[model samples]
Target chain A: MIDWSSFAYLAAAVLFILGIKGLGSAKTAGTGNVLAATGMLLAIVATLYLTRVVQLELILGGIVIGALIGSLLAKKIEMTAMPEMVALLNGFGGAASALVGISEYLSRQGETTGGMVSIAIVLSLLIGSLTFTGSLIAFGKLQGLLSSQPVTYPAQQVVNALILSAGLGLGVLLATSPFSELYLVLLLSVALLLGILAVLPIGGGDMPVVISLLNSYSGLAACATGFVLGNAGLVISGSLVGASGLILTKQMCEGMNRSLLNVLFSAFGKHVESKGADTANKTARSFTPEDAAIIFSNAETCVMVPGYGLAVAQAQHAAQELATVLEERGVKVSYAIHPVAGRMPGHMNVLLAEANVPYEQLVEMDDINPEFPETDVALVIGANDVVNPSARTDEDSPIYGMPLLDVDFARNVFVIKRSMNPGFAGVQNPLFFNENTMMIFGDAKNVLLELVTSIKES
Target chain B: MLDDPAVALTILVLALFVGVEIISKVPTLLHTPLMSGSNAISGITIVGALLAAGGEERNLAAWLGFVAIILATINVVGGFAVTHRMLAMFKGKEQR
Candidate 1:
């Protein structure tokens, strides 16, 4: 019945692939968005043309409303809220897939055979439901509505395993029978619950991995739905997402020195007994802004590492001012941007860019990691995890495998944190307790401003 | 003249996807978010695949459908695993 819809679908698929490729590089990322959006538009139009049962008015109205809501939210959201926004978008995707699956199931209720159709229905229902709930949990954690602590209980892993086993058993049962909608519903509910259970125990530090994993789940669900529909475009595109998401997840796991299973099962953010308190007491050195300025005034080269605290204090401009003042004093200043710096991905870069920091001065983690060893002064601005020495020296630390900025190797390290508290990973930073390190306790913005003034005076 | 609608639609979707992939790298700021956001777009393909396999009446089609479903399931599971891992890296000290 659909005459030319296939051609349109093919075109859309090509665009989707191109969009993803473009997304890999920073230079052409915006154009990639336009291209992807265009592909989506083409696909939506083709789908509308091909569909026989769905009403045009309803579909168009829904699109308009969704677009408006998304645009409005995007316009108003702050950078700090980006992670939650991402989580919310993921939830929306899961909900959409679930709704579509239900619609398909309802439409073909009488004509559909039980066996494979049942599997499709159950898979869609289960994955979609889990993605929905897991995304919401991630959103709540990122938005601070829920406690960021790893909510753990005795036998937590055992309970999670049981839940998964029960859910899988139910899915298998539903897949084998056509009249097992009740079992399907139960499986869906259990999967949703399992998703919540899985993510709830993970600490805030693990949210990025959770979000990425949820993203992958959402894509695979889409692919399953595509299989149910026999849509080639769905298969290809879904596979692309699933593959890329997995690779990114693997990269993230490597970034944190964690295994996929450890991430899934480990209860992160538990307060370790104060094993390093005495060590902290032995080498803790506090410094004033004036003291920091004195050290900076004489430094030949300074590397400034900014973190989420800088964003929270909105201190990018102040930091830049301090950098400029140092440069004026013949200090070769540059910013070290850890790939995973800030609350959201690239949070530091966005802030620095907003503050008019030059792109040339922003060095990535890999390039800058070794430079720290040759630097005269390493000025850390509210950064934590990226500079943690445990990532290098401590095998038992959760972040032990992730690459770190070699700030610990600098001749003099001045860490500007608000307090002596451990980072989100809930591990003590041995860097804070190092002989060359001096902790400056104050708001990042105010402290940077003071440093700028002191540098100017000197 | 009657043309095969399925074949035409397939070509169009593929083209659109290729175009998107080519253009996705335009904005440096958008690379991560777009990659993240497009995950939703990829999910939409599941609906079409499911319907196609469900509509097939043959044994071969059914087996193909089964394989597709399983592969799709693996993608979903593995993808979510990856996304969560990426997000966890940002949960460093300042965020905590």
Candidate 2:
């Protein structure tokens, strides 16, 4: 006999690898998802049959209840809310790992636990608790339940450092004396508080990095749990997540020209208001919808740049509508995507994808920056900082040295914004006051609708 | 039978390499799906949760196990469903 249960887990591990490979491409991502889910099903089934730990009725009930809630949330959540949803799931993964560690400890009940086992339990508990609470704070920021700006006060770093040192002391004490559950409880509580304190100082603009880091923490928690459980499948999948998430976090930080340490510790976005005072002398030229339409009618090529504003206005469909109109008029249309645009990585891509914009029409910043000079109009919608020339020209600007789209290079630029307000980065845009740039003030959806109408009439 | 730390460590080290290698060349557009997909995989803790829940008899261990099972199940099921929903929305240049 093949001992099908062990074989099933081996098979599941292979499927997970295949699933991750599939997800690397946009084309195969759906199939990749299915493969991973099939693997999960296999692993779950194998565990249920082989362990026979709890009654089948209890297992079935838990699965049914969990799956029902999961399905409802999956179907109901808007695509724009995907980042927070991922954060919430990451939190749950952490909680599961910690809970399993706790249960295992209670079950052991002084079974002569070795030093290695003690170390694994403490690691699982520490990482899991931190990930759980850290992810919740991330979810709160993304979902608007908490302030998206970095929350800091005097001596914040000193206070956090003290808490972390105390946490480590407790962790060490628990590992050395496994029978004393008091240290374990204290460690868990301190870890929870530490997670909250660590994430609270990071602003919403750095959310993608925060989310990725939390996802990695959850994986590391699971990996520690695997060590305690002596399970190969958990070890493999957990490390895979841990490595991939850390890489993604690094990539996002590099995209913003920021170091990971700076993003986590320094209050990056909170210093924007002080920088806003410099914009007082700058004045932007205002244009009407008809004027924008006239310019678009004569344009040979136009690139639309979207940001959080497009998402806030729910104007992705209108953006697509504008693109279609311009294309019908023999004008070429494409999108310029900033990596950190909107609340998360690839947020604008998701919004445009939702509106059914063809994938080829969406261009990354590096590929499209050179295309700007030849372009007739760079239509900036609800975006300010990413297109600001200050990133390259002004040395004292907070966004200095960050790579930005050269939207000002276009022959004519039309910026659609709600007001003269500075962007999320709190820096005033010198590009807004550039002679080539024209500002159209209104909600992006309304302005885009007018642009589509006037272009059609022309 | 797989209790050897050396064995588990080997798998962990290898899986980390495979993870980085597999995700090396993704376009910026797919980053969200990448995050969600990896999230679903992390839910593998459900295996440990199931063992904890069923391995004990009407004790604190059993209750902790049950809660772990519920949380892990949500991560697996919800993570996959959300990833699929987002991936399905991505259209190629040829699509209408």
TM-score of every prediction relative to native: 0.82, 0.97
Candidate 1 lDDT: 0.66
Q: Which structure among the candidates has the greatest DockQ?
A: 2
Chain A TM per prediction: 0.92, 0.96
lDDT string for model 1 (B1-96, tens) is: 112445534633564454344433333333245445456466455334333334425333333333333323222222222233222332222333
**Per-residue lDDT of model 1, residues A1-458, tens digit only:** 54576677668767877666655644444555567657766766676556432433333334445555555565566656667766776666665555556555655555645445556667777787788899899999888899988898999988998998999898788666565568756876898898799889988877777776776777767666665555566656665665555655665676676888887777766665434323544667999998888899999999999987788788888998998888888999999987667654455666676576765678887888878889999989888888887777777766776789899899999988888777776677888888899989899999989988887787
lDDT of 1 at A180: 51
DockQ of each: 0.11, 0.77
User: What are the iRMS values of all candidates?
Assistant: 10.5, 1.4
Alpha-carbon shift of residue B17 in model 1 (angstroms)? 15
The TM-score obtained for chain B of candidate 1 when compared with the true chain B: 0.47
Once superposed on the true structure, which residue ranges of model 1 sit more than 4 Å away at CA?
Answer: A1-3, A112-117, A276-281, A328-330, A394-401, B1-31, B43-96
lDDT of 2 at B9: 69
- Candidate 2: chain B TM-score against the reference chain B: 0.90
